[model samples]
Every structure is written in C-alpha cells, then in structure tokens.
Target chain A: MSWTRKHLLGLQDLSRDEIQLILDTAEPCKEIFTRPIKKLPTLRGRVMVNLFYEPSTRTRTSFELAGKWMSVDVINISTNLSSVAKGESLKDTAKTIEALGADFVVIRHYAAGSAKLLAETVQVSVINAGDGAHEHPTQALLDLFTIRDKKGSIEGLHVAIVGDILHSRVARSNIWGLTKMGAKVTVIGPPTLIPQEIEQMGAEVSYDLDEVIPHVDVINMLRIQKERQVAGLFPSLREYSVLYGLNRRRLDQARDDVLVIHPGPTNLGVEITSEVAEDPRASIDEQVTNGVAVRMAVLYLLSGGKDIP
Target chain B: MSLLIKGGRVIDPAGGIDAPADILIEGGQIIGVGTDLPAAKEELPAQGLVVVPGFIDLHVHLREPGYEYKETIASGTRAAARGGFTSVVCMPNTNPPVDNKAVVEFILAEGARNGAVRVYPIGAITKGRRGEELTEMADLAAAGVVAFSDDGNTIMNAVVMRRALEYGKMLDLPLSVHCEDVNLAGQGLMNEGRTSTLLGLPGQTRAAENVIIARDVELARLTGGRVHFAHVSTKEGVELVRRAKKLGLRVSAEATPHHLTLTDELVATYDPNTKVSPPLRTREDVEALRAGLLDGTIDCVATDHAPHSRDDKEVEYSHAAWGMVGLETAWPVIYTHLVLTGCLSLIQAIDLFTRKPAELFNLPGGRIAAGQPADLVLFDPKKNQRVTEELLVGKSKNSPFIGQELQGWPVYTIVGGQARWVDEIGR
Candidate 1:
C-alpha cells in the first residue's frame, strides 16, 4: 500500500487501511534497531525540525532518534531556546522554520488545534507530536504497533484507557486509532477527568477501574498530573492511588495474558505500583522502542520515501 | 432644510402603523406621516422599500478612548449607520474604561465630533471595571450615560454586585452585565459539549454563564433594580431570564445576532472568529434564544459589535481573542436567518431592533410620527448582498459573516433627516 497524506495531524480522520499501512511499514523499521549499524540512507537529504511549545521528553527524543536513524538532519527548538519566549506567534515561528528550508515540522503545543494551525501556515509536512488534549498520532501509531506485535491482531480486542482522559492527548489518539482498527475501547477514569460526550467518540466510559480490570485485553494508563489534584479534579493522590492504581493485588485479578501499558514519566505508586510497573505483563519499555520505529515509518512515508527496506 | 420621504411601506411597531405612507421631515423632526404630504425642498424616493425606525443596538463596543486600531467611535458609528442603526449604547470596556464622568463626557464629545450616528456611552459599574469599587453612578448618570456595565468582566463579588444593583435602582439606570464566572470558565476556549470534546479545545461550561445569570436575577429581585444581561447565549440563561420576567422582576436580556444564528458546532473549523465569550452554544440553545426573542423573554437583539485586529485573531485558537465584528452584518444576518425563515415576521424583527431596545433604555425615536426624530431606515427585503472585507465601513474586518450571501440590506440609513449611509449599488 502507498502512503499519500501530506500531514499527520491526528488519528481521528485516518482510515483503517492508512493506519494498517503505517503499522505494516513499522515492522521492517523496527528490525533496523537490532542491526549492527542502525542507520538508513533513505532520508539523507531531508531536514526535520522539532518545535515543542510545551515541555516533553519521550515524544521529542523518539522523533529526534527516528530522524537521525534515517540519516535525516533534525533540529530541536524548545520554547525557551526559541523566539517563542519573545512572544512570536506559532504562525511566525512556523514560517521562519519554513524559510530556513525545513522539510518537516513536528510540533507539540499546549493549545489544541495548534498543529493544524502550523500545518496550514507552512508548505512543509507536519507531524503532531501532541497538541493540547487533541491528539498524538505517532504515539497512537506506536501503541498500535506495540499492541499488534504482542497480540498478533487488533480486531475485537478489549482495550481499556485509564487515568485522566479529559486532558490526555495520548488517550484521545488511541481511542481514535484503536477503535478504527476494530478494538473495543473502554475509557476508565474519574467522571471529572472524562470529558463530556466522550461516548460519541466510540468509547464506553467507566468510573470504576476495578470492575473493568479483569475484562480487558490491554490497559493503557495515562500520566496523572499532581496539579490535577491541586485543581481539585480528585481529592488526594493517596485516594487516587488506592482507587485507580494498578498494584499487584489489582493485577492478580486481570487475565494472565493481559498487557499493561503507560505513556510514561509514570508517577510511581500513583497510577501504578512499582511491582506492577516491573511486571512481566507490562509493555511500557517496548512501547518506547516501538515509538521510534513508528515515528521512522511516519517520517519516511511523509517524506515520500517508498519501498521500505 | 426640510426633506420628504415619498411612497414607502411604513412599519412603525411602536405606533402600530403598517401602511403605505409619505413622511415629511422639517428641522430633524417628523412633521407629517400620511399620504399626499406637502412636497419639501429635498425628496427621497422609496418606491418599494420598507420604511421603519432606525435600529438601536444596546450592546456595542466602539473601542474609543483607547484601542483605536481595533475601532474608534467614528468608524464604529459609521458601521452602525451602514447596519441601519441611528443610535447605539456603547459598552465601557475601553483601555481607560468609561468609569468616571470625565470619560463619559469625553465619549459624548467625541461622538458629537466624529460619530455618524448617535453614541450613548455606558459607564463602568466598577472602577476600571475591576469589579471592586463601584463607580459614582449618580455623577455618571448626571453626565448622561444611558446605562452602566462591567462588560467583558463579570462582577464576581456578590456583595459588590448587590451594592451596584442597589445604586442602579437609586440612579434609575439598568446595569448591563457580561455574565461569566471566570473560575468556572477556566481555560475554556469554546462551549463545553460534544463539539468541544471532539475538537479537543478546552470547553467552557454553560454553567459559567448560567450561574451568574441566576445570581444577577436574584440580585435584581432583591434590589428591585433593572439588570440587563448582555449577549445571553445559553438555553438555561434564556430560561432564567424568562422566569425572571414572569416573576415581574426588573430583569431584561439581549441576545446578539451571532448567538441567535451561530452554534458551537461552527467552532470545529477552528476559526478564531467563531470564538466568543459565553462561546457559541449548542443548536438547542440557539433555538431557545429564538423562542425567547419571539416570546419577549429576550428583550431585543443587540449587535455586541466587538472589533478586533488581524493580529489578535490570526493565531492559534487558544491564543486568538474572543468576539467578532457584528455591526455591519447584524441586520442582513438577522433578516436572512430569522425573517426569511418565517421564525419571525418582518414587523416583529424590526420591533426587536427598534422599539424594544428604545423603550427598555428610555431612548427617544423608535417610531415615525408627528413631532418625532427623523431617524429612519429604507430597507429592501429582497436585495441580496455578499459580505466582504472591502464592503465593511468599519476599520476592522473581523466578521464571521464575511464571504456569506445575505438578503434584506438597508438601502438608506437616515439619521436626523440626513442620509448617513446610502447603498449606492442598491440605488
């Protein structure tokens, strides 16, 4: 299958075939990491810029590594190091990057629809690293790749996304991606943390995480911010950990083959306990490795590189 | 100089007159309104047009005394004239907001010097609209402010709001309020609902506006003062105002044309022009507002004609400023959406724009009769016009109606016996 999209803004509008093609391409992309020389000359002449308005570690590092592994030039610009601190608008910053001959812009902004704005402003391809609570397409693609690698196929699988679904771009992207691939997604979170009309997005909402733990094929836990507690989303972190935390006791109730995943910087003993984070069923580390592979697939496809090696 | 407006279907809702008539004007006042009126020195032929009282908008932001780049009284009033408005009560949200008698007098003087239409300033309810200390309401009223408001900033302090309402009762001036509890509206860029969830933009709940409306209605009942809601955009807000009116409280509300016509679903396009405070609500809320307007729960339709520059709007959805330019598009949009759709009769629509707002504020000239001000509009309901940036007389072209085709444009907007804005193409 051929890839034709100019920008990877979100997973919501992506067709099942387009998503499968990315997953299918990422299979070969993952093999390069195991080789003695982990580099490809396919995108040698391409230049990719990472423009992050919000602070992020894994998504930025993953995209940078993916670009470098493909022999592409990658330049990183965080908010403080760029003119964004001087109050330059997203449009101006994007146009400046385009003027400097950047072929791709991977943006992660705090405001929703910011990536779409950058995509509209510049001629280059855009990959949404994360835009507010909107979507993280590559992260979802990598999650899909990791889940498919373990489970063989995505169809009819029960996937539960727990934690703050209201403000989690990762959960939004996964819900769109997993559901499109025929997975039944049940979003587990506090009622305040689950946004209004989320059922319309093809996910069933459940407040009680314990009831959903045993019935799911995969559980993806989103990072819960301590500030959310300060904002009174929940009463206390101790209570939150007691209620939603995936400890050994709670993990024992799940199916033997059930996989636990997290988009990390995980607050240990908060969303998940130390024992469960290191459990054999946890695929968090593999998800990170697959993140690079999936990103490589996206960068290759968006740069018009055909014939996966 | 005297002028004669000949052969028009006059619709004076205030006077209950809807008939073909000729109106004679002398010295800026109507002298006669009947057939076979004596010919004057100057004559305007209105063959098949509908002649009605000049529109009065209760909520408009002229942006004078500061923020001239966005709009000035001169440009705003010209926009008002083009939209067939002869008088407008400007909000007090300027740079140095209209808090004192000096500012009020300054606005009145500027309006007299540069405005194409009558400009009535609304003094701030609080000093600098900070919602702390109440402004000198008596002095402001003596200085000729038509109303008082802390628009764009809700008076969050309930005690302060109560005191302001008490002063409003003593001063006999309605306090126009911009209803929003900022804490409840935290970081929200659009209405909280399915669309906001789908778009991933932070959602402002309808409770943010409704809770304050409920508060102000109780305060109005307690203080026995007139509290006018500015740009009520939710079904719950309409219901609150409707119930308040039924309880015989001195509470009134105005709905903007954008609120009545547009919905939150439009924000899915991520256009900043669609961003507004009390951010456009659901389709059900729009229907409720229309129903409210029809039933007199919503007293009148105000433009809430907020003007912003391209620099303020041409950015990310979260960073872009709220509000859209509504002055020049108000009449045609209301005409196209409400009048042509049979939701409201031509006369009912005109009454909302004319007599209702005038009577609510006790402003003069809402009807064409003997010894009345000759502020009038000649509108052609069938005339089609496309809204464009170049067509706008206002300095800023931040209107959402740009590029849409609408009908029923005002052919001529006459203020005080003189044609202030004439549609040359229509002529």
Candidate 2:
C-alpha cells in the first residue's frame, strides 16, 4: 500500500489498487503533458542516471526528458560507449554510478533478471527502464496513460498489443498494466511469438493479427523481432510483412478513429507502414509526450521524491 | 563436548533393543546407550520422552546453485532438524545438476558452511541430468558422494540404465531412480483414475512408473547392481519392488509422507500443492504402502522436501509444480498417524526413522550407538504438537500440512555432539 522505496521492477508486483493509485497520480502528469510549456520542477537537484546495460534510444530519451523537465541532472551511460565496454561489470558500473550520487537509476538490460540483481547491489532507488526482455514498467505506465488520456477511462476498453509477445518486455509489462487497469487485453502475434501461457496472465491471445486489429479500440504494434529469424521463425521479413505487418490498407480496415500505437524507433514498414504512422489519428507524439510525465511519476514514486501532492 | 540424555525410552531397532535407557554422547557419537551407567558433566534430562537415533532421510530436494528461492541447504537442513533428522541425502536435480566434481563440492561446501545436519549429496548419474550421458562416478565418489540419482527426471533408456547399474556397482554407488516413463506420463497433471476422469484432468497411470521400475529391476539383476526406487507412490510399483526383493535381487524403495497418507482425491480441489509427479494415488495405494511398511516390505519413509514461492504455485494446477515442503511435518505425522493407529509399533516406527534409512543409504548414522556419529533426536513423545505454517524454520511456506494436529514432537536435535536445534530446551 505504501509506495515508498519499493522496486517498481514489474507491473506484476503492483496490485489492482496500487495500479489504480498510480494511474490517479499519473492523471495530473498526463494533464501537464498537453500544456504549451511541458515541464515540471517536481524532482529538482535529483540525479536520474540512465544505466541502460542494453542499447536503447526511445526509452532512454523518455527517461532523460522526464528527468531534465523535472530539473534533475540526467547521466546517459550506454553500455556500448561507457566503461562497461572496457571490461567493467554491470555491478561495478552501477556502484560507480551510484557513488557519483545517483538518487535513482532507470536500467535496461538484455537479460531477464538483470534489473532485479542491480537493485539488490545499489543503495539508490531503481526504476526498471527495461530488464532483460523481462519488463519495462514505465513503457507500460505511459501506454496506460496514453489510453486513458485518449479514451477517458482505462477500464472496459478492448486493447490489443500485437507483435513478438515472447521477446518484447513491453508486451509483458503492458499486459500486466492494462489487465490491472480492468481493460481486456488481447495479445496478437504469431503462434511462436505468443508466450506459452499468455492467457494465464488474464489476457486473451490470438495468432491472426488481421482478425484481432479490427475488433480492438487501441492497437499497440510492437517491434518486429529480428533475433529469432535465424532460428527459422519465418522465411524472410518480406513474407512476414505480407502476413502480420500493418500496411495502410490494414489501417483502413480498422474502426474510424482506432488509435494506431507503436513504442518507437518504429520498424517503419515492417509492423506499421509509414502512411499509417504519419496519420492524423496516430497520437504517436502524444504517447511520447505522455512518456515523460509517466516516467516522472515513476521516479517520484520510487525515490521517496513523491512530490508535494 | 558431552550430552547425557537421561530417562527416555530408547528404541534402537537394528540392535533389537527397546525400553527406557540413559545415553551418554561425546564428540558427536553415542558413547553409551543403556540404563544409568555413568554420571556425565552435562546432564540434560529427557524424562518421559522418546530417545532415538538421529533420523536420516535418503531423499530430499535442496534446490540451490540456480533456484535458491525454492530451498537452500541452510533452510532444508534446518527443516530436516525440525523433523528430527540428522542426515539427509540431497537430490542432484539442480539447474546445473551435481554431475561434475565442482558442483558436488559446492553442495558439500554449502552443507559444511551451514553445518546444521550432515548433508550427503547424491551426484547426478547423467551430465546436466539430461539422461543422455553418465558422470564420472569414480571422481564423484572420491569427492564424497554417497549415491546417484536424477530425482525430478528419469533415465528412460534401458541401455543407459543397464550400463549405469553395472558401472555403479563397480564403485558401490546406488542408482536411485525417479521411476516414471515420460512418454506414457506425457503432460498428465495427476494420477490416471476415476478421480482424474471425473475432473477432466490428464492423469498419469501407475503403469508409467511401474514399467520403469520393472525395467530397472531387470537391469539391476542383469548387472547384479543395487537400485533404490525413490518416493514409491503406486500400489503396483510397491508390489513390483516386493516381488523383486523376493527374487534375491538387490532392490529397495522409499515411501513419502504424502503417498502414505494422502490420495488422488485431493486433486478434485485443483490445488497445485497436492500436484506431485507420479501423482498422489488411490486410497488403495496408500493402504497397501502402509501395510508394506508394517510388514517390513517398504524399507523407510523419506521426505521429498520440495519448496517453491507463492507465485510459482499461484498459477493453474496443471501449470504449477509437483511437490510440497514436508520436513517440518514428517515425524509428527508419522508418529501420531502411524504409531497411534497400531499400524506400526513405536519401536518399528523409530527404526524406519533411524536405522532403516541409515542402513539403506550405507551411511554411518541413524543409531544411538557407541563409536557412532553423535546424531540423535531428543523428542518428547508425549508432546502433541499442532503444526502451524509459522512453525517452519525454512523460507518456503509451501506446506500442505498447515494446521495439522499431531502427537510426538522432537525437542532437541543434536548433530555432531552439539545441539544444532533445541525447541524450548533453555526455557
């Protein structure tokens, strides 16, 4: 019940009541997102360190933007360019970063349980940016905010997060978030990409993306997973695009104003066509805008820096 | 160090001894076991209590190296002590199976570091417990591995079983089998019977486990090897082992607390805690196993001490795990349920707890004997303890026996001449 210093590593850790409270707190953050001057001095002088052990552009930028808007010093330590490339382990790198007075860290790693380990090692509060294909709680939070901001309510709306459900930590995090908010989430992807027990987490799962896209109110298209292509997932990317990819024609088949969403650095034509992405109804920039507010809320909730609310 | 266990009924079954006696223990071995022979420096009176050899269980699941959340050696051994056991054989079904010397040493070192009860780690026969290849038996034996088993999974191939048996005999390593044919028991959740049929759950047949037992018995016979069938649940499996023993082949078996007490009917509730592999069988199976234990056909009762977190068990019954943590409830249940029912004599019950398993595993334990290791369970036999979930020392609360009321509880468990655990001993 007390949202103080607890690890927001995954949405699974949060109960329905806890999630609802987060949504309520994020309601004001969402309001601030659409303002002409979209900034808040909520976390002034706080250091938000982006210790992404894995590479990222979108999630890192979102956290950095959230930090900067709150007047916090943001440090971007990409594992590729940082001292981690010079044989520094994740634990030591985090320790070094923590020693530099990082109040909170938004971490992303390639391994499923990396964030959990880093949390135990450091004294600083950890906001799981993404954990080794396990969870990206802020992404789920932003997605929830985006849906509620557009639809006026989180509950009872049919939401479909489509793509490689197994590899995408976003899909897992979103499933937990969306389901907790009382929305019925249908996960649409290829049979193999659909996790072994998708429905067990209270989400309806389907393999045929075409049948699913027409029914859902919000369609969240995840990135086309290229890592599994060599493992004989599909014949090629073109063939996959033919079956599962969302083209302009696919978008035309949806309801009149169904929100076409993608967590970005989009694959452009693979999961969604450029025509569909640039549509007036996409609200993709709105999602990016809501991302900052949602992350600010997460950092506030975790760092005992829960603003004067 | 010395311990004077005064005024208790000593049941040393292997020596065919019973009745009240005073035990003088020194340097972790029993020095004297009889009526009032010598006055000791430290006299701990055990008046009107049950004094027996420290209990030994041949089978226990200590999930370490990879899955520490389930059961660590520290917690598992602590649970064993709570169950009145002093030595327990840890199964090798870890993430990286205890096939290599490094892993075996790691498990041993953990036991030594904790040093609650003596942990005898059973090395995995196959590398990674894949059931494809065998581990270096000689090398593992040198590193102090007493037995070998792939506990969670079975080696289904006969060629592998035969060769393992032959080579296992060459080094005196007993091949403890988790007897179940994977193909027949494929994806089944519970035991195949009237109950599973009614519940619409896929059930495993007794035939699945028995077929493997029959095959392993033949392999053990062909190679003149010793085979220990672990956690024998089915009526048919026990019958096969009983018959195999009659044929002069070296075959013995262990019955778990669940198999002896619980039945497949609990599966109707759809609780995953009751969901064990080689699933809990019919009441007929339970009765037969109990009868076998009474007549000395079933050798000993082993606690297959499995532990898991709440989330691991919160899922659907078919998807959840197939085990329950039992070390904390073993002695109380066995004593109250079996001994009080006249199914087993108190002395006989004590023997199964001590000498039977100690003799079975060929470990120098499970006796209140002179020159033996000072491993003993100082129990207040008259004390009827009600088991709550809070009573367990282990981190896992996956016990199905919560709120179980039973008589006969261990008060002080002394391992290696020191009091490792003493329930209300000081107070």
- The prediction achieving the highest TM-score against the true structure is 1
For every prediction, compared with the true complex, DockQ reads: 0.83, 0.02
Q: What is the TM-score of candidate 1?
A: 0.98
What ranges in model 1 sit over 4 Å off?
A: none
Best by DockQ: 1
Q: Could you tell me which residue pairs clash in candidate 1?
A: none
Q: Estimate, for each residue in B206-277, the C-alpha lDDT of model 2 and write its tens digit.
A: 889989988988887899999999988888888888888899899888898888888888875556678786
lDDT of 1 at A104: 93
- Residue B209, candidate 1: how far off, in angstroms? 1.3
Per-model root-mean-square deviation over C-alphas: 1.2, 9.5
